[model samples]
Target: MAASSDAACPADPPAIDLRGLTKRFGRTTAVEDLSLTVGRGEVFGFLGPNGAGKSTTIRILLGLVRASAGSATLFGDDVRDVRRAHRHVAYVPADVSLWPSLTGAEILRLLERTGSAVDHEYRGLLVERFALDLDRAAKTYSTGNRQKVALIAAFATRAPLLILDEPTSGLDPLMDREFRRCVIEARDRGQTVFLSSHLLDEVEALCDRVAILRSGRLVEVARIAELRRLRRTEVEVSFTGQPPDLTRTPGVLETQDLGDSRLRFTLSGAAAPALRTLASSEIQTIEVRVPTLEEIFLEYYGGQDR
Candidate 1:
């Protein structure tokens, strides 16, 4: 008998379904009243700073920790039904650990046999692409190399859902590119990906939507476009003299004097108001651009340590 099956089951229910889920360790609440759903074939981003309950939510989904209240299910099967629920999932954590005595190849084969069905052809290609030395012992691998091993194994599996939490922690720029490519391929293959990362740019590029958590509670769930739309426009105007007094402008949030008769400020909502105000000034040149993802993320975190 085969150790695992690659056969995909019917996906009528969502890939992940959490309803009013909460977890508390005594008086400390790790995740509170969290309700979220990830559809089949959707790439969803899970974002939060440290101590935001992201890890606890993941643990509940994996059946590693039972939720104190509410429910979490995968394809309609309760996560508590570990064996059956696990059949549809593959997960890679930020820090990977393997048997020190086993060779890289052995570990790969072991994970395939124990976790999910193997995609042998894809596995071969990933091994080559990641440039992993399968003959070497796990104990000899560095942090980046260990991450590569786990990523290769996870990407080469036939699981219908993937849960990746900070999976690219120690990878270099070149390997980071490889990881992004694999994520795209996984989406093309109709896999539902739950990506948890501090890399806002990566999330912005790969995920269709994201759920943001803060202080053990769900703050928001929005599409990437919607999040970008919420950002204010950054307008930098160069004048013929001292900057104008647009601080009282309806849409301008803050202003900075860029010297050389230039002013930079953030404008939110409709630009018509700011534009009208700028038209009255002796503007020599004007530059308007949307804020970057990092800037937006900081806004969500209030520029605090995350």
Candidate 2:
């Protein structure tokens, strides 16, 4: 994925900016000293495990909750001034709940009226694309359908900024694809997207940059490629004879004896030194496993010292 064309520089005010944002509830701190920026027209991912402060940060940005300290801004306007900043924003929560007596179409119209502008043509297109049945009452719709309704409304508003909190939670695989497409289309139209998700694959596929949080603290923020570079590959080797001793090999982080002439080790950085070490043994079979996004995420939690 390429970086956003309008990525905010040092001198540029970001589409969304949070500086030392903190939130507390009595004795518990939900967020702490967190800060980041989402550029104009960027699909930025706020990623973390459950209760990792993703929702708290988003709520502050949306002005649904006031931060205990620090500041948040939308399009250069302080989010504390809710009305003005919210005029350019649209939000879709993770768990969507609509008025039970209203039909999907009615709900859509109501949401549209709240926004500054609505694209009727785009609304119609989204309804069709999501395969939503607008005639049905809201209470009769499934969780996925309710999500579709919210998505359609958000996309149709033509808002300059979209805040989607796990927007694909109840969507099937097919609808998930359509949702991603809509996000990309929004980006193409110069809209900024702040996507909060625990789904690593979704973030990897869509985001220009990702900020990872752990224990209510920001852990890392980098492009996907840069994050991937931090991962180490696992290599398993089986030999006809004795396995080569690789304890001192460069780039080899750890080694394990799998017994019966088999060995397992993790290789970081370049594979050249590891490969040469493996070649010294009578290799019968070898397997190299690339780390998955989940594994990389766990690594951060498991070894914070990294």
Candidate 3:
């Protein structure tokens, strides 16, 4: 009898799930009480600064390392059951390595053969788009070229889930944009992406939701927009005349004078009062800047040991 696709695995499980996951190495703890879920077909970002345990958590999820405490599942299958769970997932490490004797083309072919299915046509297009010189030997490829090979291989797999750890680290700005486009296309094809990175702009542009890690703990998890809403806005104004006083404004936090009629201030919550105060001045130019992910991360866990 032919095997049934749904016999062992159900369709409704989340793409990724963790509960109180922790890992300790002797006297040090790498990850602590971390928990989050990535929905099917969702682009979820796992973000943290260096030594914050982002890579440790990803290793546990990939079954490359065992968690000292708690549980992690991929598509409702325990990560410990590597053969079963990992068959549905594809991974791209931050630092990619290949056989010295193999050409980029050979490396790609080898990786594709290891997967259950390969989208050869798409893979070819990606190779061209990335400007990868696949004819060259793997030993001859530059950092960016090696990265391109890994990215193309991972993206070409017809796996239901993609686990990318700092996948764009070696790419130039143009390649980075191309990588984002490929991620969106994967999402459109109903594949889930778990992207781990310290690059705030990448997460801001691609992820639907984000989980931020700090000193081995899960600190915050929310939609990107919701997280942004919690941050204070930085506003700067240059006046034709003297700037109006904003110290009395309800939402204003800190104020500074940039000299020559320019004022800079941070506003939390509503901006109505701040706007009213700005209107009272003869404004020459104004600029409002939203908080970046790094700023938000610092706000939560800055000036502390990791």
Instruction: Estimate every model's Cα lDDT from 0 to 1.
Output: 0.91, 0.90, 0.90
- Per-candidate RMSD, Å: 6.4, 5.6, 4.6
Compute the lDDT of residue 90 as modeled in candidate 1: 90
Clashes of 3: 0
Tens-digit lDDT track of model 2 for 62-138: 88999999999998999999999989799999999999999999999899888858889988999999999999999
Question: Between the candidate structures 1 and 2, which one is better when assessed by lDDT?
Answer: 1
Pairs of residues clashing in candidate 3: none
Stretches of candidate 3 off by over 4 Å are: 1-11, 239-248, 257-261, 276-284
TM-score of each: 0.86, 0.84, 0.87
- The ten-residue window of minimal lDDT in model 3 covers 297-306
Q: By TM-score, is 2 or 3 better?
A: 3
State the TM-score for model 1. 0.86
**Candidate 1: regions farther than 4 A off:** 1-11, 239-250, 255-261, 272-285, 303-306
**Considering every candidate listed, which one attains the maximal lDDT?**
1
Instruction: Candidate 1: give the clashing pairs.
Output: none
